[model samples]
Target: MQSQWGIMHGTHTTPVGRVRDGALDLLKWLALLSMVLDHLRYVGLSLDGLYVPGRLAFPWFCLAIAANLHRTRNAVVTGHWRYLGWLLLFSVISEVPYRMFIDDADTLNVLPTLALGLLVARGWQQKALIDRGLALIALILGAVFSSQLMFGFFGVLLPLAMLLVFRRPWYFSVLPGWVCVAANQWQILLNSGSVVALTGLVACLIAPLAGLMLLQYAKNVSPPAMRRWAYALYPLHFLLLLLLRKALA
Candidate 1:
């Protein structure tokens, strides 16, 4: 099928050049902001009702990853490696603050999960046995460490599912949406009576379509700066939130 980036079948061309899409950067910033608001719930806003906004964070990040992958007309391998590296680096850096900010949190935060999802998507895209095997290992690790703060095993899987259905059709997000619901079942059910739950459900259902639409319709946005410090934002933000929460307490 044809997409804004041109034809969508087969492997992306090699040595892909930079594709500037500002909407993605904007979305990333929005997602990050939403995540901060959500984390604030733990700090002192449990009654303030910002959790729903926070719900947009993970899916948005996943969508950004998928959008980046889709836009790279070539250099799939380089893109995958670079993405994986960034995720890994941030995963390590973000762990301490993630644990400190979220009481009793055990997971390695979302970056690692995203890294795993990147592996899964890259493997699926490349059709390589080794990559597939690595993806399975990552999935297993995610499950074993499910107690950790980030989305756990299911969280890791959500992005892969998102990548799978990307650009296919609007209806494709349903399965992933169900998976997302299952991943956060109790919370979803508890929030069901309220608009938050409804919106969360709808977001999961439409995330892929929304992401695809953004990429296709909003490709004119500038790409985010891919710098080392950008990754640090994850941990730094957590620390800042932690300090603010402590002060408020």
Candidate 2:
């Protein structure tokens, strides 16, 4: 049945032998690093140059979502729900810290956008009616609240775009690569005319493909597993950074 869906949907959902892929762990760790680096700019440091690497964070995170969904396409229904529940839970738990650390935050923390992206990607990968309906609702909400979404509607679409090109050739990843740029607000970056902003624009453009290469060729490279508890890191990092900012002040 799963194979049938794979064929009909033109997805590479073949179940693998391993319980976890190390490449994915590596990707997660790198994404975490990129995120931390990005947030460091807010940590009372004059590290505006970090913005270029920070541009890599969101797309890499989205690629992680797509990679996980692609690999676990055959997992039990409850597992999928559990995955989403964790994101939703952390979205709420992380918001206060996110707002605290990010000065004048206009949007919610990045988790809510990731949660919606997950639903949209799952809708594309799963044949279940519930999945499709949830994706539709996610899309509507993303559209209605795009201004409130961290990366806006393009960010919501990024996971699905990554999933679409997950198993395809590396060139195919350019689709999501462009989406990553848009999600990062390439226009504003371009118009800024700063060297750092332009560098960030280029980083966003290639972040997805860079991540895909890591996933494809780095399977043997082991890293720590990024489990459900890792969700806490999202909020905890903000608190730690906020404290650092206070100390620096």
lDDT of each: 0.69, 0.86
State the lDDT at 234 in candidate 1: 92
Q: Write the per-residue lDDT of candidate 2 for residues 1-249, one digit (tens) a residue.
A: 111122114345455435788988899999999999999999887999999998888998998888778777775567778889999999999999999898899999999999999999999899889999999999999999999999999999999999988556567777998888888878888899999999998898888878877776687887888887899999999999999999999
Q: List CA RMSD, all candidates.
A: 3.3, 4.3
What's model 2's overall lDDT? 0.86
TM-score of 2: 0.92
Distance from true location, Cα of 231 in model 2, Å: 0.5
Error of 1 at 210 (Å): 2.7
- Per-residue lDDT over 62-82 for candidate 1, one digit per residue giving the tens place of the 0 to 100 score: 777766666563564665677
Top candidate when judged by TM-score against the true structure: 2
